[model samples]
Target chain A: MKREKVVVEKIVETFGLTKRYGRQTVVDRLDLTVSQGEIFGFLGPNGAGKTTTLLMLLGLTEPTSGYAQVLGLDPRRWPLEVKSSVGYLAENMGVYGDLTAYQSLAFIGDLNHINGLSQAIYEALDLVGLSEVAHKKTGQFSRGMRQRLGLAEVLIKNPKLVFLDEPTLGLDPDGIATMLELIERLPAEKGLTVVLSSHLLHLVSRVAHRVAILDRGRLMAVGPLEELAAHAGVSADLEQVYRYFFKNHSQVLSEATR
Target chain B: MKAIIRKELADHFGSTRFMLLMSLVFMISFLGVFLAGQGIREVLAGGGGYLLRDRTFLLLFTAPGAFMPLTAIMALFGPLVGLILGFDAINRERNQGTLSKILAQPVYRDEVILGKYLAGLITIGVLLTALFLILTGLGMTGVGLVPTIGELARLAIFWLMSVVYLGFWLGLAILASIAFRSVATSALAAAVVWILLGFFVPVLGQTAAAALTPLEDPARPRAEELAAYDHVSRLFSLASPPALFGEAAVIMLDPTHRGSEQALRLSTMSRLDRLLLNRFQGVLSVAQSLILAIPDLLVLIAFSLATFLGSYLVFVKQEVRSA
Candidate 1:
């Protein structure tokens, strides 16, 4: 059963994935898998290499060593093909401030060589609840609006999978709720697999079907919340499970550095 | 790439920097025309309209600088226009957090840098075209001098030369933007290079020549010694882009300019004396002048291409995630 799952329908698979800068490894020998139409939360403390791993998967950065396949395509060998099929909303993603929201989406559409962009652009905007402000310049947008616009940009390509990095950073309470709701609904409504990386364990626990805990560039744990919680001999609380692993794994980091 | 180019062109045209710089250029162009017109008025008064009948209408560009001529002004200040337009092209995108987003899109890596550069080039082309048309129109209306077909073609050639000259600076600015992370740092770096090439380099060339080949009796050196001194000075200045472009423009615009005797390989004095014996032969033929400026033009083009390729390689090889 596990072999069938591994070979048949996995959307993301990385084997011994590693990234190093000079002598310091930022992502170390990570083996991970994400099935289609699942919310995979990537949990980490600061400097845990979450963003670097995402960059490697998206072909923005190359791994020092390892094999990664996204949606059955190798990012290193076929980046454009991978990019066309997978959407990525980078941490602190930027919009062209002088461009109207509609224009920005259309620009992304053009980059992807998407034909008949007007309807797709409008649909994407509608999905993000920014339809009313479609013609407004992005410079005048609030933080929430910009994030939504970014979501619209990601959605315009209609990819099978999306990677959203810290999508709720700097958002207000209401904005956070909106962004989280959007991410949660993407799998059910759009049939899109998602990899969401963030430090907010509570939020990830609420929205993600499975969670991976990372610390110091290593995959500390990866599984459903209850499974990981039970394995750690803790209650099915993501914070407890994360803390249990963090406390255990932080020593490995210090030893490696030493 | 087309989308990027369209967006960049819109941004540059709508920008306050382009507007401010273009207005400055516009004002300077008008002032140049006014100054040249006043000089022409005195000439026409002294020698009548028949005196300039045989001269090409493009002579306004190479007009002897009673005040600084238009080509001279462009040579001096054109780098500012191109530099300001391009210095912040990539770094601003990086700072605003847009560069990574663009890179993440499904396009080849060179598309972004190439599109931005093409946009800058197109913007410059438009500005120069407008300036050329305006200057030609003003010459016709204000001074009642209409260019012949050959003269118009020469003007077009000069316009193209101007673009190539300024493009070298634009490419340098883009390279600086890609190499540096901060907009301020890139702009300052580009400006400093511009200042060196535009002002300091030529001055340094003169100082270097004086230091190396000091003439004890500086007032009246022998002909061969003076020629040698000029040759040494020219050699030093050749490293400067403005000096190269300046020599090319002067030669291309004024057909009578055979080139500096000390720097040029061929002595044109005999040819000039032979041509002067014929009343209608004060200037070299158009083909001859083009041949004279070909080497200068080739050098300018080669430098522009080198800088452009340098920027291209830097941009393609850079790590976008670092931004």
Candidate 2:
């Protein structure tokens, strides 16, 4: 929390960002913004459009109708530019089992056209605490190690912003703590903006400066935890704030049906 | 794109399945060539130089041996290599959840597919070249005859065509990989396509051709009927890649094989005229052989490009799910 110079520049912005697969709207009209140097959390359960929205922002999937900007570049028009600057750790992301950790990072480094590749790979692996097994095949890695390798893959590119989707999905407690610590250090130590998406409320609250609660492709509430909790008339705990919004949303849905 | 191509090449070359498949192809080819060489040696020993014919060096590939010629074996099983290399190209990545990770980078969708297809093509080219070189070495030692420059040129052209022929299968397998979600489904689909096009379609072509143009006199069909049968059968067989490869390979490998229709027309010629025609049919120069085989070459290239383009379009437009 270095707040010496508080210049809130919007790192990501979207207006009416909607994504529909045929008749189903996976992501509805949504306006959102993330400032530079903050961990933005996208909190939603499975099939709630969290992953879909992340894909749209990364320009991996085109939005049905709407606009998205990543690092001041329109994602649809400048996908490569946006992607080059933004690292994305997709949900359930995996590594080549046959490839050693070093080889895997080397491939990513090559893709990003990183100069001094060997040095970069070493730094990335060391940062994720995976240097001990750099030569070991990734197929032998545990779930936590693989997840950490995925993070190393992101950091190897030295991206200005990173989108991490359920990065600790199947990790043990120790693994989760290590992953969180790595994430928590990104903003301050590396000047990276992180947009972390997960359904785990407490973990997100631990690292994310702001969280956006979504349900059924719609944004329910978004703000700092204290601000959101205050708005929802609940205590400043993410779990309580999340329940407050979700309960009201369900009631609103039932009323609309009636 | 270069990075992707390099990575895919490493994967294809290092995989155990690829090693097994390569060895299988090697053993089959070695057996075929060895048998052909023994048959050639016996003829040469019996002072049957006339029977051995021109382009004797090329006989190592086209001569019948161990149930089938080396060319026939290639036409049948070369596709398996391509199919195995590409059947799970995209889907396996999607299944392992690595596709999204790669796509999320600065790499374009087309680059991914194009790199994969190129890697597969390069692998096929290397495999075919190495196989041919080894067979040629065996032929030199066994037949005790050095290949003339003309024989060498024809061998080179045949090798290039084989690469393209197998490249078509690689493209089709990649298309299957992109179209199907599950790796198992794509693998099954590729195998099914290989069987349908390689074995079933050629047989079906013969059946359809016979049905379309039945000889009025089965015991001794008229020349016109024979010509009609040849024309109709060739037309049907051309629909299959293996048949295309086989037909084109004949003209490229055997200089004296003028054309299928030409051979059938000889049946209508007077006995003396047929004899003269057979004698004068002489070995075609490599340039002439290439000119004759251009149509098949173009078609094979088109088939390969079309399948690859199909995969590209499907992949670019398809939504990438993060699984």
Winning candidate number (DockQ) = 2
Q: Give a tens-digit lDDT track for model 2, residues B247-297.
A: 789889899876676677787789999888777677788888888888878
lDDT score of residue A28 within candidate 1? 94
Record all residue pairs in model 2 with backbone atoms less than 3 Å apart, i.e. clashing: none
Sorted into a CAPRI-style docking class, model 1 comes out as medium
Best by TM-score: 2
- Candidate 2 residue spans exceeding 4 A from truth: A1-6, A250-258, B51-54, B266-280
Highest lDDT, which number?
2
Model 2: per-residue lDDT, tens digit, A99-161? Answer: 999999999999999999999999999999999999999999999999999999999999999
Candidate 1, position A243, lDDT? 91
Question: Cα miss at B262, model 2 (Å)?
Answer: 2.8
Question: What local distance difference test score does each model get?
Answer: 0.85, 0.89
Question: How does model 1 score by TM-score?
Answer: 0.93
Off by over 4 Å in 1: A1-8, A250-258, B48-56, B64-66, B261-282
Q: Count residue pairs with overlapping backbones in model 1.
A: 0
lDDT of 1: 0.85
TM-score for chain B of each model, two decimals: 0.90, 0.95
Give DockQ per model, in order: 0.76, 0.84
| TM-score on alpha carbons, each prediction | 0.93, 0.95
